[model samples]
Target: MSGVVLNDVIKKYGETQVIHGIDLQIENGEFCVFVGPSGCGKSTLLRMVAGLEETTDGAIRIGQRDVTRMDPAERGVAMVFQTYALYPHMTVEENMGFGLKMNGHAKREIQTKVAEASRILQLDDYLKRKPAALSGGQRQRVSIGRAIVRGPEVFLFDEPLSNLDAELRVEMRVEIARLHKDIGATMIYVTHDQVEAMTLADKIVVLRAGRIEQVGAPMDLYRDPDNQFVAGFIGSPSMNFVRGTVTDGGQVDVPGIGTVPAAGLDAGREVVVGMRPEHITIDPAGDTHRVDLSESLGGVSYVHLLGGNDKIVVEERGDYRSKEGDTVAIRPDPAYLYFFDAASGQRLR
Candidate 1:
């Protein structure tokens, strides 16, 4: 029942407002991720929840307690920062039990809790090793182990995998997912990486400039975004937007490409046709498009195309490959097309 709730939460430093009033409910045992570009206040909001930052103008409730003004130690929440933040002089076991030691925990009790955390993180073998002796991934596990030893009601991760290498990031992502599955604890994670958000989060909160843009399940946001920003931000290769004008009989006229059938819109209205890269294919009989470059990555390739003043990337799978400077016809699937108002950048039904 230890769910986190933020009601009209706002953060500001004097007159410079950063996090606007954000109201959100993170259910118990839910893996909620606050994801957005840098300076979007994702970390700030997480800090506010952790009691590391003050909630300037709203209520923050963790479980049944109103902890808007509570001290960090009294919040009953554990935080794992991006850095390992481990003590170089102390072994893994010592570092993991340091917080409990300072809190006047019994030596036997501390050892028992540390042992359980070590088993969970698979750090049992590295208990005797110092931070400097362990690898980056192992060090991070030590940090997480420290938090686990606290036995807090909630776990907060602030870009915990950003410090790892690409392969280690993947490995740790799997490890964290497994950890959540095992404990089923209420967790809140913050990261700018969309891949991390998509893979790790049960609920994704997309933010922009201190404001919430969208909040939903990962694939839900990817398949049906509320606006153009969410549509463009959630996907790996962003959605392609081509400016066009609505023509006769509710048909949208794409520049450099011919008219496409679109209903429920006024004629002669300016709009942007949104198409995901995966939905578009190279058709020989389709409109001739210029291929700028191709990024071949083993199983798949992303073909970059120059369409008028914009750049569009198409994901090609299997044996299909497009060379640079090749003229190909780009055909977009009619069923998957998305329409947005050109002026407001809002999705059009």
Candidate 2:
């Protein structure tokens, strides 16, 4: 297993800079995920570490070796792409062993490696089957098995599960997590899916438009996001941002909702109060509003309340009978309120 270190790494396409200077240290055997929206430079940064793209400046070190200028083949890293990239005509065994064969490994060694990888991936039964003969999930496993056979120090994945169905993606995600635990190799995965990042990563690096937004454990980023963007991006339903101005007495006045005490915050500043839907409850003795929509999602129901121009989504336990135009009183949990600077979107005390 090997750790990856990036020191002031930057990537440029001629004159346009895509990846701003980024410094990150991924621990040995750590499953680090890079996640963000499209055009966020997550994939660009991963390719740079894989040596598939040249870094315009700074250094990349895998283990003790500086591989910034090294060829992709020379870097002790294996990359699994989103498209599965398997050879159409080659059998599973041949495809898995192709890299070792091209590198002039002994025939016996290639066979042994292929057999071991197939067993690990549970692809032994399909060893002689071609890509066309396998299902999407099976083909994906072959792609991963090919990487495993290489015995790479670091594995790079660029949205490898994006092509799979929703159900298959979940299954493969569990398999990948188990594979990482069994192999204990440092893995860097790039994906736009927040669920994948939250579920699979030991550490998540959140990026935004070529810059690092935040890097932390999944819950850390979710509970204490540095800004509105990170908070909104990390959560499922996204945190609700209610515009309010801080009064002289540490009270914030929302447009529709009446003034509420700004706990742990100074007064006389414009702020945005953030409340998660799960943190808000339908209070029996609270301010009343008309429910615009209620979505029952098994264990919990998301109740969308309409308060004049302002809207609040409250997540309630069990089956909620509240429907459109029904009156309900929704109150946010005080302890869960997040305050952000209205102007800069920075968190406020």
Candidate 3:
């Protein structure tokens, strides 16, 4: 119903600070996702928003009210966690209505809310089944249905699909995306999986070492990352980094990938060149690199090659016939090349 805002939020346990000062705003009906590697504090930040974890410093406002110190029940946000946390003995209908029942809502009101949530989640046929009778995805949907019954101001998902199998993860991603479209509710999701973040988020917050790294729409982050950390982390197969030297003639010299004019950098400076796998083309007629491995997945193939001491991955669509142990040459798109400061790991602009 309303937006959420964090003002210079900080979190610490004892003397160890896990979440540094974080300032973020989630617009009404926006799907914001917090993503990063393990121990990066993405979950900690989401829990802070849910009131499940305390904000050590700064303010958290949900709509117009400051909810930094509010109890989880008073925050008007429903959180679906990594674990299902369902009652084994309760039927799906009962489970969906349990929260309202515990709050002393009338039976009719609970049933009405539960029925609406059931219809939204397509759980009508399984309402009479207990947790023991439902499949993994169904149980997870019931878990989400429980949250939907609360009619909260915001929805928080803490890697809710982490427990599902590969196929179910994809299926639930569609379901969750559709749920957001159907409800138009503000949702904050946390995940270590960038694919989920890329496919689901209206905006993504990338975090590392208790601090916010970058925040933007998925494609924006992928196409124009602020630093090498982001450029490498946001894409699948990761970006390739190779040692390069800015030559006296204002050209960047890279082994195996050839030379490109430097982007206003001083001569004799060292830099790191980044190339995305999809932007690289393998030359079967030339031999400058050796194919370390090759994997074909239907129409797309990932060819891993060893260029000097650097490892490069080349993504080829349709029919790519590069095999392991072949001596091949690779070329990166000049327009897609990214240069970063060798010392600081920041983009060279």
Highest-TM-score candidate: 3
Clashes of 1: 0
**Shift of residue 85 alpha carbon in model 1, Å:** 0.9
- As for lDDT, the candidate ahead, 1 or 2, is 1
Give candidate 2 regions above 4 Å deviation. Answer: 284-288, 308-310
Measured against the true structure, the TM-scores of the candidates, in listed sequence, are: 0.98, 0.95, 0.98
Model 3 lDDT, full chain set: 0.93
lDDT top scorer: 3
Clashing pairs in 2: none
Score candidate 2 by TM-score against the native. 0.95
- lDDT, ranked from best to worst: 3, 1, 2
**Model 2 root mean square deviation, Cα atoms:** 1.6
> What does the lDDT come to for candidate 1?
0.92
Query: What lDDT does each candidate get?
Result: 0.92, 0.90, 0.93
Give the local distance difference test score of model 2. Answer: 0.90
**126-218 in candidate 1: lDDT tens per residue?**
999999899999999999999999999999999999999999999999999999998999999999999999999999999999999999999
Residue 267 accuracy (lDDT) in model 1:
94
Off by over 4 Å in 3: none
